[model samples]
Target: MKTQNFKTITLLLVVFLTSTSMNLMAQDEQERPRRQGPDAKALADKRLKIPDLTDAQSEQIKKIRVKAQQQTLPIKNTMREKRARLTTLSTTEKANMNEINKVVEEIGDLQTQLMKHRETSRQEIRALLNDEQRVFFDSHMQRRHRGKHQKHRRG
Candidate 1:
């Protein structure tokens, strides 16, 4: 009877630990931000729904996106490292304001460069579009931007 009781308690403890770990893992996943790839052409295609995209134009846009992604990847990686360092610095007891400000400025510069690259890519894609397609693209972009802001507000 003693052995049976011990076995049952052990089993209950194991199940409880397993469930607790799973819940913690799920929470960790929810806390992490979703990583976006630089290209994200599929997102554009889905959102814009540009009709009658010629094969040639599609290829050109793909090339443009891929090139942009390639150029930005290194910069993005460096920015990510800087961000991690900033986070560490901010959490320390003796946080250095000057160092934090410098990192923030660097991040802002990297973001500006990224925005410029994105705008250039958008122009390249827009050049490929017809008048009607361009209009659709513009509306799609507005809607996407509004949705992003709304999400932030709600969240």
Candidate 2:
């Protein structure tokens, strides 16, 4: 049973990594947006407003977003399981600090992985953009940051 659980978790990690890598590879510098799934389409639409993306750049951003989603998969799964476990634990089970510590440690690891993967994906996307596109994207991104900061300041 223990071995089986380990295999299942490992398989999930493998799937997450493979899917992210494949999506990143699919990004070319000359593609346009299409309505694929609602979420993907919504993301593409949002990105379109920032700058006039050529088909390739749109695909590249889409790939980056997809990879970001993939990086969160394991963390999402683990959180769901932990929440369920916490909900079901009897008073006795809840009292075991060691068991709780183990779960907390796992959550911490997942959070670290999430940040690391996101940063790595951002670096990969940067590599995909040319000088002109990168400049445009960076400027737009700065504007977005400033806007968000303004919003926070106003509230």
Candidate 3:
């Protein structure tokens, strides 16, 4: 009786441990964070042939990005609302190319302002960079702007 009881308890313990571990493993997988845009920034810094920025230049770049985002927030919100409205719209309503063009123009105008803002910010940062950093920075900026233009053209 004692040996049977010991076997039963040991078996129950093994089963409980197996089930708990599986649950914990499943929970861990669900809790994992999704990689997104900031991950791209890290990867860009790592894999790009560009020279790294000085601390001051990096801080200034961050500030510039923040300022540009803030300045464009209103336009972004407006565009979001327009897009949402368009999604709810019927094909006939959506086929109004002129209205769509107007929205595109508004977004383009905002994008122009954003580009200017980024340029100004880059200038501010450029002042703090060494010649090598400046070269890398210019290349980075050109690549970024070119990508943005291509994306907008597609949209």
Candidate 4:
């Protein structure tokens, strides 16, 4: 009876430690600001050194960016909500795998949608630039894209 009680205590202790650590990790994640993408100022910056951007091109770029943000904001919020739901479901004592899987699929679909929307926004912005500006924009975009992945590769 004593051995059985010790085993039970150990199992409970392990579970308690696991759950405590997971919650702390989640709190750390919540505290960190996620860089979703370039902000409004970056999108509409007039001094980006893009080979002499015209007033018209700058205005058009701002409009395109504002529209894209309006379009994607809801999707982003929904994805965030789904992710929170996933975290809760995953941490439950008796996780409902089917519901978790469904939320995961929804998050993936939202991610794909976001990616396509961002690419289309980039293309629209690219359409406004002259040849020299396009070259500069493409190079800048490539560098920005690579910077994100390079961080993950290093990690």
lDDT of 1 at 69: 99
User: What are the per-residue Cα lDDT tens digits for candidate 1 across 92-132?
Assistant: 99999999999999999999999899899989999999998
Which 10-residue window of candidate 2 scores lowest in summed lDDT?
A: 85-94
Distance (Å) between predicted and true CA of 136, model 4?
A: 1.0
User: Ranking under TM-score, best-scoring first?
Assistant: 1, 4, 2, 3
Cα lDDT of model 3 by residue, 1-155, tens digit: 99999999999999999999999999998986545666866653454344665555555666766887787787778767766655544255347776767766776776677667767766876777788977887887789879999999998
Clashes of each: 0, 5, 0, 0
Q: Pick the candidate with the highest TM-score.
A: 1
Which clashing pairs does model 3 show?
none
Residue 116 displacement (Å), model 4: 1.5
Model 3, residue 75: distance off in Å is 2.4
Candidate 2 versus the native: TM-score? Answer: 0.50
Clashes of 3: 0
Off by over 4 Å in 1: 1-48
Candidate with the greatest lDDT versus the true structure: 4
lDDT, model 3:
0.72
Q: Give the distance in Å from residue 12's predicted Cα in candidate 2 to where it truly belongs.
A: 54
What is the lDDT, from 0 to 100, of the residue 78 in candidate 1?
88
> lDDT of candidate 1?
0.88
Please provide, for model 2 over 48-154, each residue's C-alpha lDDT reduced to its tens digit, 9 standing for 90 to 100.
46455567766777788887898789778887787666555525634777776777677677778877887787677667777876787678767877999999999
- Structural similarity to truth (TM-score) of each candidate: 0.69, 0.50, 0.50, 0.68
